[model samples]
Target: MSEIKKSVFDAMPQDLSDEFFELIAGNDEVKIERIISRGHTSPETGWYDQAQHEWVIVLQGEGEITFADGRIIKLGVGEHINIPAHCKHKVSWTKPDEETVWLAVFYS
Candidate 1:
């Protein structure tokens, strides 16, 4: 079998939309993906309530996450967090000039 190899910080599409996500690998109950963000934030009126748990690490740039309970978490390169499923949270801000590369593993 062949293998796939790529850089998480590689250049993104020149005409990308709001943000970009790429599926790397996964199984029936778990998944791994890469999220690339630049000046992106969650919707002002909503928070993410996912069905799967997420463990994420930032590989580049910086970001902030706010929880429903008024908790704000800041992350820089090499920082990480584990978000439980169904937890209400939203991305508050992201660095605008550089790509914020994230490595995330999601599981039920």
Candidate 2:
């Protein structure tokens, strides 16, 4: 078997919006997705509910995320946090002048 495989973003569907998602890994235990989101402060940006447990880390740029409990976290490159499944959360804002890259790993 080949020891290396191309990452999902190595070749992704370009037709996606400024916010793009690519599944990078999945198995019986976990699923990993990479996200590229830009200009998150737009009126269109809002909250989300995850079906599975997730942990996300900022790979680039800066942003803020808020939880249903009204707690907010400001994240920048190299910072990471975990979100439990079904927890309501949202990306409040991201620098429009820069891209916000996130490495999100989800597990059941």
Candidate 3:
């Protein structure tokens, strides 16, 4: 077989602009998704009752994650956190003038 030589930043699909979501692997036992999202948030919007556990990290920019219970967490470049399944959370606030790049991995 031939070698596949390409950088992750270079090989990201051209058609998928605004954000990059690559499904790296999946199976009955586990699933993995590599994502690079920039400025992807609903301003003034919130989320609730997530169905799956997710581990999220900030690749760049600045933002805050909030939960229904009034828990707040701040994320910046190179920071990360884990959210349990069914945890009601949302992007409470983000830098309006900057892009927030996030990497999220989800699993059951």
Maximum-lDDT candidate? 1
Cand. 3 TM to true fold: 0.66
Error of 1 at 14 (Å): 1.8
lDDT tens digits by residue: candidate 1, 38-102: 99888899999999999989999999999999999999999999999999999899999888888
Clashes counted in candidate 3 amount to 0
* Estimated TM-score for each candidate: 0.92, 0.79, 0.66
Candidates 2 and 3: which is better by TM-score?
2
List the RMSD of every prediction in angstroms.
1.3, 3.0, 3.7
**Arrange candidates by lDDT, highest first: which order?**
1, 2, 3
Residue pairs in candidate 3 whose N, alpha carbon or C atoms collide under 3 angstroms: none
Question: For residue 50, what is the lDDT in candidate 3?
Answer: 62
Count of clashing residue pairs in every prediction: 0, 0, 0
lDDT of 3 at 59: 69
| Alpha-carbon shift of residue 5 in model 2 (angstroms) | 5.8
TM-score of 2: 0.79
Error of 1 at 92 (Å): 0.5
List the global CA lDDT of all models. 0.90, 0.79, 0.69
Per-residue error (Å), model 2, residue 99: 1.0
1 versus 3: better lDDT goes to: 1
What local lDDT score does residue 45 receive in model 3, on the 0 to 100 scale? 55
Of the pair 1 and 2, which is ahead by TM-score?
A: 1
